[model samples]
Target: MGAPRRATLRFTSIAIGVALAIVASPAAAFCRSTTCTGDCPRDADGCKTTGKQLFWPGVCVGVSLQRDGSVNIPIADVRSVVATSFATWSALDCGGAAATISFSQLADVSCHQTEFNTSAPNANIILFQDTQWHYKGVDNTLAKTTVTFDAKTGEILDADIELNHAYNELTVSDTTVVVDLQSVLTHEIGHFIGLDHSPDPDATMFAGYDDGSTNLRTLEADDIAAACAVYPPTRSGKCEPAPRNGLGDACGASAPTTSGGETSGCAIAAAPSNTANRLLSLLGLGLALRVRRRDRFRS
Candidate 1:
């Protein structure tokens, strides 16, 4: 690809909705990544059948937390959870294995929407939908991660997270019945960074999540290995932990109580593309494919 040109592209992982508490419902499904594949090693304990999708090796990925928080938890606490989730993914050293990419926490943004803008600056945001979770009909989703990438080589250009706060209750406490915000963030961050669900029941990337389980808050062997494969410890990228759009970590504003509105004036969510879908099918992950867009990449 030549000098990157702004293109309308999109990828999505459904987190569903906000719940009052995590009840013992049916087993929750796992995550998916369009960039990852099944050419995986079998020796890792938790890595059983999970494939790998990684960001380009030489860029310091910047993540930003929106100033929105669930009614049940403080926004600052939510930002802390986002930071720790990034840390867990970046700190993987499973013995000698290393992750190629690293993350820097950018400043907080006023926009609580997930969007990639070519005309204006945008932050890779993690926003809480306090009043409404908007998707077709899947209301049970807890959160969703959207990534825009170069479809040709799977080079990630931008990514964002949206937490469903309108339909359910979410918190950062250890109440055991409530959805662990930290645990869900950790899992969603996996998708933000390019990971699909693992076949291993013990893996954090496993598509299956149980209510009140904290295991997903940390990395499993498979999760570590997958991170290592995408970003080795030896790769090169500056450690820039500053917000790209000049927003700061100030929690004075309450996320709007309305059901729907624009978070940023510059971004529009791109729809899925058929070409990307065919490519995912060729990769043996058509069943697990959650995102597809052709303009997101250049051959």
Candidate 2:
């Protein structure tokens, strides 16, 4: 049997919901999210751990915002924050040449649910749960990111970002800050790509957050190194932002039903005829257990 698909749950704190061992190289301090479990293999430098590293096969990825805005924040402000968050990564400079990744903002979507469709088009959605945050750690959890990828190749198929506006106070203003929206989204975007938490406590991919702290809004040296390593300037791929099948707007009719095998926190859904045997892995980040509050910073 192939490697079983599974989901990883993380949050902006010291505690990660799942048990994922970080294996880093002597030279680098960042970790890449992998597909396999335990120590399967390693690269020349030992920077990459076992299993295939998760990555988007194409150069460009598309993201859609849910039409329903947050209870406190407007949809326009949310869109602006999302754009800025993606831009922070897209604008990365890998020692002059830019990181080989880009994001395109698709039209607003009506579907608020997060799911992957094997037989239909899909959109990488960003939604806010204003009414209720259904996950385990509601009070401390700020947001959750769900990423779906192919088990064999580690090609990311779909990703979704859900904000915990119901339980926590999420603010978008730069001057007056609570749980900085851009900072939270930027960190989640790191997970959305293929990065695991970094050992560097100051790095954007670090599994910790400071309330009213905007340090995560920009990439640190470690964060830049991680981005450059995963998506180098020489990497080649078409600028395809649409999902596997195509761009989808709704979730009801297009979402596929589960079949075949099952794993913890992952759905064993049917895949397209061309990609039948390959399994898809779904990882959910943002445990929401605790939020470390640091001295507030006003910009």
Candidate 3:
């Protein structure tokens, strides 16, 4: 019989309300609201303020996984993965910040199932496996937790990777040449970096992979915004906020309060709240751009 299907893991932060279930598929679902929920606390607007609020105060990051049972990718290609991913996220109007890609030494081939225990999560490492043989349509997966270190000492304790079921046919070649390693890595990395399934038919982060769109190698605005929210740029190098069309304000500015209450500069300041929102927007734009760019070159 096939291996037991892993249960969907859920993360609940005090910042956001909805419980985000991390499914073992590339196309995971996300809450649509901008605020937090449940035990997740929120600002005056009732948004949850836990994990999403903490790590992704303004921007989010994306990561790609290394395939299991495939030839090890050279360090150069790994660097390329980092560079291309960051570039894709740099073109959005969200907060001007850069995204990062980190590498891990552990191989997913360990294939040893880990039991749930109290350990820190590792956000930098990615594990790849071919789930296609067991599950016909499955491609890649990412775990839904972040890796954090002790604020004072920067020590790591645990990490997570979304479970993937299909583990065969990931390294097969058509003409005796190795299948495009970069292409597959790019797709898995998109998930590691926090891109959701794209509705755009031609986006690299799109739910399905099409050979015709192999070079769809850019990030969409959404992807950028997400990564930036996770890892924002420094103030000295911060990109100027983009103008909001018809909104009559800069991208991060608050709406005019008709009641004349105190305007908390949280939206404009480099402080945490403003930074968080800006980052998320940046990541979203980044992903959107990658998709659009890939479509452009492919066509």
* By lDDT: ranked, best first: 2, 1, 3
The whole-model lDDT of each prediction reads 0.52, 0.65, 0.30
Runs of candidate 1 with Cα error greater than 4 angstroms are: 1-32, 35-54, 57-59, 240-299
Looking at model 3, residue 34 earns an lDDT score of 22
The weakest ten consecutive residues by lDDT in model 1 span 258-267
lDDT of 3 at 73: 43
TM-scores for the candidates: 0.64, 0.75, 0.37
- Name the runs in model 2 displaced over 4 angstroms: 1-27, 37-48, 252-299
Best candidate, lDDT: 2
Ordered list by TM-score, greatest first:
2, 1, 3
- Specify the poorest-scoring 10-residue window by lDDT in model 3: 262-271
Q: What TM-score does candidate 3 reach?
A: 0.37
Q: Could you give candidate 1's per-residue lDDT for residues 46-154 as a string of tens digits? A: 1224323336434467777776556678877887888888888875784565666678887667776655543345567888887786653224456676666554555
Candidate 2, overall lDDT? 0.65
